[model samples]
Target: MTDTSKKEQLYELIRANPFVSQQDLAVELRLSRSAVAGHIASLIRERRLLGRAYVLPDKRPVLCIGAANLDRKLRTLETLQMGTSNPAYAEEVHGGVARNIAENLARLGLPAALLTAVGDDPAGSALQSRAESAGIDTRGSLRLNDTYSGTYTAVLDERGEMVLALADMALYDKMTPEFLASRAPQRSSAAMVVADLNLPQDTVATLLQDARRDAVALVIVAVSQPKMARLPQDLHGLRLLVLNRGELETRVGRKLAGDAELAAGCREVQAQGAQDIIITCGGEGVYHTSYTLAGEAGLTWLPAPKVDVVDVTGAGDAFAAGVCWSIYQGNNDLTLACRRGLKVAAMTLESPDTVSPLLAADILEEISEFHPLHLPQD
Candidate 1:
């Protein structure tokens, strides 16, 4: 067989049995052990295989803590009327900042666990079941008895832009610091811990503290404008902070404009203890800064790939997942990680669902033909 075919065969076998040894491959393919070793080495060098197995060794299961809810969207076919009922089509799907991020990570072939509260309602059951089916460990999740599951309802215009929305996330209030303390072992063992602002302020504080104590990378996703204030004032020990310009402005308590101003805002947050900051600008793209052992890094901006916008909802969650996945894969390059995030966000923009099933596959390959925008240096 040609080397290409031999490589393909080796790839299939390794993927099928991640722990398969070289002797096993030689026995199954009726080839010399040396031949199998050569093919495997080629695969690893070509980037088709990751490390000694299909997954990286340091890529441990991520612990995602926040909200899991049923998302309801009402899309109007025509102009919406004010103070009057308008005819529209409605759709419901699984959603929640943390829940979506966890599912995205699982779909990307990473092991993920979710720690959040859900009601004893059917919607709650469906959410948990779907997450588990996607390979997320939901055992850390809570099923509250007296409350109904949280929900996010959005009214969209014909163009798919959100016109208005309501979030009934009172259920997340039950996910307090004391409750998280009960799950300390699981929290401390994860390679990374992600939390959204939907979590109570005290709960977020507790998570930050635990992340510091355990030396786990803590990634925070700012849920929304109003909720951004819930984050701890001192962001020290935060590994990554993903948010939009508005959210960053809110966090810094100032209005920022221009690249210089935004870069300064990133530095302000970094001074307060955040190691890396990614601020997403709608349509324009994403800007990121990181503090490494070499000292402060310059701002790197990657423009968003042009795509048809189907729905803006959940795009941020997708972005968060991509960045976290890159970090889990042991990539310390902030610019590349932000590009991965932008790629996932673009995929979400093309789908009405919070997360497109297409995201379950290799995104880099899917967009290989497209070129990412490179901004001019200052």
Candidate 2:
């Protein structure tokens, strides 16, 4: 059959039943699974088909608030560096915790909006343009005139592990509570509000307060170890909290070396009122726990799938996107959500770019077909 004929058939099938899964579509259309997946991806990319399952019709777009900046990296050709210069390769791209998460969500076919501050320079303009191109609504973002856009530079060893990094993100200070207050209506209308610690402490506090007062689901991403403490002590209205092992240690005010210590830290944060907590332990895998009126859900850990390491720049952001996407899709199973998060993070780990272009919902479905994640029992 011709491509147009196949697309028309697929469109008719979807219009008839919006909840049809890709496997079902393949069977009904008498096409290969990958072919059906590709067609669905193209349809979504061309705006002929919407991702109905990935988002709810009644919910507003997810609001993401935090840093947006340019990222530069230098990878040494060989291991050995002190004060002297080393031969290396250099590259640059637009990156920030909130920006990466927002882009990943958009790529996964979710309605996302970004509220960040950037200078009026070329870098800021490029960042905004790229974000918009990637389907993120940047209307709520700020454009400062005098300051330069934020930038993060990292030096990596030959194995692609980060050796050292430096950041100039003072522009994030402009994303104050006053700035967020100006966009109060937008923040209140969101289905979920996601923020990273790149924002100032006062801004984080205001966001927490607004989310609580408005009764919106708040998801916070710990940008780094130092910034994790910026989160408010009273997480009364937090729906989900995403952080790494180091960040969790900082928040709990102690060293956590084993599963026992990690579980204690998770309980401590749950006591602070967060409904769910996801901690990404580099290679060991991810630990997740959910709390409800019934009681605490037991900790569920999923081992990370083995993959060739490329650059671990935005794996955490991709994981956050997966969890947020799953929640927005109305999935309450923490274990399932963690599996999805790991799947997405694995995809990101294989890509050198921060956000892989192949992060679409359909593409992920196809990848999972061949390389399914084995979830641990509760």
Candidate 3:
């Protein structure tokens, strides 16, 4: 067989039998063991097909910059009667869109860093300690003195759904353009940069522009409510954008009444300059779109397996991190990439708080499961 044909056969063999050895390939392909090994190395670097037998992180690092806030949550199931304004219970946790993404990226075993501001108080200390223990770099995270760390209060019903939210992020408001600019050179090696709308518009724009100029991949997660519409308008070739189904429709100014509509809406957003757009339908799946050489193409919907519902607090951030990690690892199988995203989201929702219970290697393991078809055959 031709060399190309042999490589294709090798890739198929590895997918069918992930743990198969290079020696076995040598015997089967009539090639030297060293030749087979060299081919394997080339395939891996090309990210054609990957397996758990050999997966490595620390290969690419992710940088996250945005807001960090302490969250207080309350649990209550009092359905709002036609004329009632009362909640049953409330609870608290530490959460912010930026921090959530950071934690999720860390859990995915990718080198991750958080650049934000916090108070120089007990709450800030706790946040620092928690992030550090998770193997995240908190050195870039700032601490402001004589100021209270930002905090958010959220109410949940019996179904673990968000009822209302109130936040005080004055401290995070201090992460101005100057602060980010001063730290830019320190993170010139980042593989990707993740941001959200919690920070000021100028800050978001500045960071995106810098990342683009520096050639770092950029991903933005839309956080907060309808009042925060400035998010979609900031679109300018961001690597990816993850938003809820409703927000997707509203931002695109299209009525995505159903799955087909949602798919079309994602394409529309892609036309607006976002390199990739994903519309996450909670409990259903995610609708996505990406640009290709031919034109903007529709994405295959990746379904999330039904699981016991817990809290959906950090699911979106988890999903974003998953996709971001896969992109960094050079995996382009949208289907498997979505699965990796959903898996991390599920892990976070399985808990009451926004904290990620998973480790980095576990996330990498998920990324390794479904190799991209682009790889040569085993």
Candidate 4:
């Protein structure tokens, strides 16, 4: 078959079975596996297809657009209740939801960029230095003089679980539509674009809509506080929306606190316009459902393998990064992505840091001891 004919057949095959194997494509197109791979690469570049599944086939970078702030971590010998004020040991660390994602991506060997606004203040300088050290591209992020940098103050007990958090994200609120519009082309090249609700509603809305318009793979991290949970209800075109069980319940104004609740919540969110949904239930693992182009219409659930819970601070973000990267690679194989996500989340829990203890080079080794990607049903 001619190249055009092969491309057409491949599209039909994918549309019919979005999760079809590339080996299958090679056979059906009557082409060498390399040739099939090259064609798929071209199609991805043209935005004719999104990510495929497998081990990181494309090294395309991930983009994170959100807030970066300095974390003033307050440590106490015992838990400091949220409302009870007391003197505590405090230390400043680089933090923010978007910055955390970027650091994790860099550690995963996926080049990532952060497009956000930070103040030109000393705290902002510290954050910039830390992000640069992590090898994140910050060219697209802007610095403002008038607005002080965003900051978070967290009070933690000896166990390291947070007692309360106070966030000042007013700087990020200044990021405008025109700013993102100018950066849209760069954003469009992303293998995945991760966003958090720290941004103003208009800014977040613009990014999601632009991702849809440009056909970029999008990963929306619903970083829920009682405040962030009021996310705009009209997120129509996101490829994936990642949230914790409580956040999902709050967003939909319904109870979805278990695996079954998560599954139902995924469907509910999908109906609201997101193409795929995942609700992470702390110890129970992740509940994922996406519109599989192949199987029956609607969503399908994949359970992430369970592990002992430690720190839960960054687990959801780590899971989002893993699933987004896997899905971008054309692997709609939810079980595989979930396993990767769980592995990353576990690594984060085992460490003191918000990212993972394992670096990019250690991912394969870390996951190798776990159940293989294609787990067999007994």
Per-residue lDDT for 263-378 in model 4, tens only? 66666777778887766766566655644434433333445555544455666677777776567667766656777777777778776667775658448334423332221111
The most accurate candidate by lDDT is 1
Query: What's the TM-score of each model vs. the native?
Result: 0.80, 0.80, 0.74, 0.74
Error of 1 at 90 (Å): 0.5
Write candidate 3's Cα lDDT for 216-316 as tens digits. Answer: 77888877556246564555748778788777867877677765576677667766767777778887777666434555465555677687778877777
- Better model by TM-score: candidate 2 vs candidate 4: 2
What lDDT does model 2 reach?
0.82
Between prediction 1 and prediction 3, the one with superior TM-score is 1
Q: What is the lDDT of residue 350 in candidate 3?
A: 82
| Count of clashes in candidate 1 | 0
lDDT of 4 at 168: 81
- Deviation of model 2 at 98, angstroms: 0.4
Model 3 weakest 10-residue run by lDDT: 369-378
Clash number for each model:
0, 0, 18, 8
Candidate 3: segments with Cα more than 4 A from true spot: 1-60, 77-90, 232-234, 290-296, 358-360, 363-378
